[model samples]
Target: MNYTLHQLHIFVKITQTKSITKASEELHLTQPAVSIQLKNFQDQFEIPLTEVIGRQLYVTDFGREIAIAAEKILAEVHAINYKTQAYKGQLSGKLKLSVVSTGKYVIPYFLSDFLKKHQSIELILDVTNKTKVIESMEKNEVDFAFVSVLPEKLQVEGIELMPNKLYLIGSEKIDNNLNESPNSILEELPIIYREEGSGTRYTMEKFISLHQLNVKKKMELTSNEAVKQAVVAGLGYSIMPLIGIKNELLNGELVIIPVKGFPLSSIWNLIWLKNKGFSPVATAFLAHVKQEKTKIINEKFGWYLDYIAK
Candidate 1:
């Protein structure tokens, strides 16, 4: 006859996530069902407990106060549940993770292997670009994300992932008048670029500016594959992770441009909200990633053959 525990659980998720859709995904409920519950909860209140500001929903002062109380309530309930489950000695849950595009290449292999080790868990993944990944993290859209850029004012925690070296690659198909000289490489080839807000793009621009080179951007793309494909098609030259283009480099579809200091590298990092409590599954998954990072990098990509015949 009173509010159900399910409602409180869903409502608490809503407060933490600040979006109906994110809460629905985390709680495995339909959007309409979440909306109905939200409306019911709001109707019970004397004043609206939240507001929308610039596409993000915020808990009002009163709502914030109540949500803090709700957090304590939920924490206690979960602690009890966790202790009971620990007594049973079972680990079964879903890990919800989102990642940036470049991470799409690296994170999955690491995650899959972790899943193999922890057979009782499931990995729910959403692979997106850096901008969306950061935005979603700020809004509590995902439990965790892998990123290269850590923005200011985002309430998040970041742990450094392994550093991947960057390289400037030119299509063997394009630079017919090729030279091993870095200056010549910069002087001759058109620069292909990644999309705006990309960490790779930022790094590339900084390096280019630092080196004081004239840029002739010929093409731009969002996907790493597109950038590589553009380079391979002889459309232009580009900079990217050396890890991602190993095959192309080995096969001679792409050539590592011999610019004195053309390519630059940076570290990637793991991200999660500072404010949100980790679900049991998410916690286990984070631990797994931390443990497996070295193995992931060291695992020789043997099939990593230069597939293209030059």
Candidate 2:
């Protein structure tokens, strides 16, 4: 009948993940510690809150209700903390964010200034594929998420930060040929694909489908860096976001092959669940993004902006 809010927080995490092991990892606690806490929590109540069935954690109906209550309590606690900090004209809290993999290139520019302004704030950033990012958003796991493609199914509020332009990139060896015959580049050079579930891969697929172009598949890489490396080695050409290849293009390590329909445009958005409570940190970040987006983009991605506009 009596348990610590700490234990309830752990219980909520366990219920969300359906695994004590995962909950432990997320909570940055060892398995034994998490287990001890869970046992101590259950000892407080006469009924078992969760049962281990088939090597998996299953929350009882009572456990679900307890988790819901814990969520509300934790949210209220966070709001109170945020309000206190805001009233003091200070920004101090952990900013939890999940970003799509490619956003690794873009989010830092936005975060750097914010961090400089509020040195007291801590950041926890998770870089993952769009699917996992969306799952985190739906579960209310992060304060905000940065992504180019927004999920149609999730109820979220967001503002577009900047245009995400995808370009056909290849080695300099084919520069002359690519310039002469842009369409033939697909037939001549094998196309390197990003692995499944990538937002980049999804956009490439859409572009391919729209053009009805049959591209030669040579290799599929799991990361944007791997794909860029493969393309630089002259293994194949890849359709990649310009943001990811800025340094390479600037240093002439990779060449952007001009194509008639290329530089496919998408928008990067800073998004959060519409129903989730907005903390002071989250609100500040949202306002910062909107207010400084143009300046940030112009500074960090001016070349991309110029290229896409051409």
Candidate 3:
């Protein structure tokens, strides 16, 4: 019963992807190499770790448990390395953040300099939907959560980073003569929407309900990028954050339609639960954000402010 760390790593990846090919691709190893290692690892145990049914691969229940244990082992190894870095007088620990999908555009700029300054710190940034981000915060799984809309049910403290502006956008190919009235445009074009549990979806629904707009429901997509592509293809119009569509807007691939009470706005916030204790790495990241947010916004997102002003 001797197994190497490399075998454990391969097995963990196989369980995660449930496909030998995918595991190989993710690990940057050849398929034959992954298969050989997996076979070697499987031989060390009597019980089967994975099974193939038809063309699909599945991790057995035992494999799932082993993968979880493997994850814990890997994390411990990372911690040991971090400890050595700390003995060298470097700030070394994991800084984990769960950010809503659209925040990908904003959070990276905020993190870039901080991560550069603390080269020894390990950063784990998960870009996911708002529901998952909030759930991670509630479970105390991450050090911070970045969202445009603050959760009403969570007792959390947050710092406002910048304003997020949402506007109804369409392909630039849309006719200029179409009625600019909010209800008219909404009723005229099929409206692409983000899926339920998304922060953007919540805001869009609220706007629709408030205006009593009868929007033609064209389709629902799960991500901002998907919605953007749908709109760019002239599939429909969607209310999207200006931050995510800067490139499309600049390239004239998309256009903001003027409507009454347009550009619904919210503040982007980096939040954590009130009772949660922060690690040293998390504290340093928070401080870096507080000191650098203004500068980062002015330098990286000034165009967004100017666009909103017009």
Q: List the candidate 2 regions with Cα displacement exceeding 4 Å.
A: 91-99, 115-160, 170-172, 179-181, 195-198, 219-226, 229-236, 246-261, 267-286, 302-310
| Best candidate (score: lDDT) | 3
TM-score of 3: 0.90
**RMSD per model, one decimal:** 6.9, 4.6, 2.5
In order of lDDT, best first, we have 3, 2, 1
lDDT of 1 at 48: 80
Q: What TM-score would every model get versus the actual structure?
A: 0.64, 0.72, 0.90
Give per-residue CA lDDT, model 3, range 174-207, as digits (tens).
4544445677667788899998889999888998
lDDT by candidate, in order shown: 0.74, 0.86, 0.90
The residue-by-residue lDDT of candidate 1 on 1-310, one tens digit each, is: 3555677777789888999899999999999999898777777778888888898888788887767877787778766766665567866566777777777766777677667766666567787777777787777767888876676678778678666567778776434333354556665668889999777887888877776777788978988889999888888888887768877777888877545554465677888888689877788878877887766656743332222111
Ordered from best to worst TM-score, the candidate numbers read 3, 2, 1
Per-residue lDDT of 291 in model 2: 88
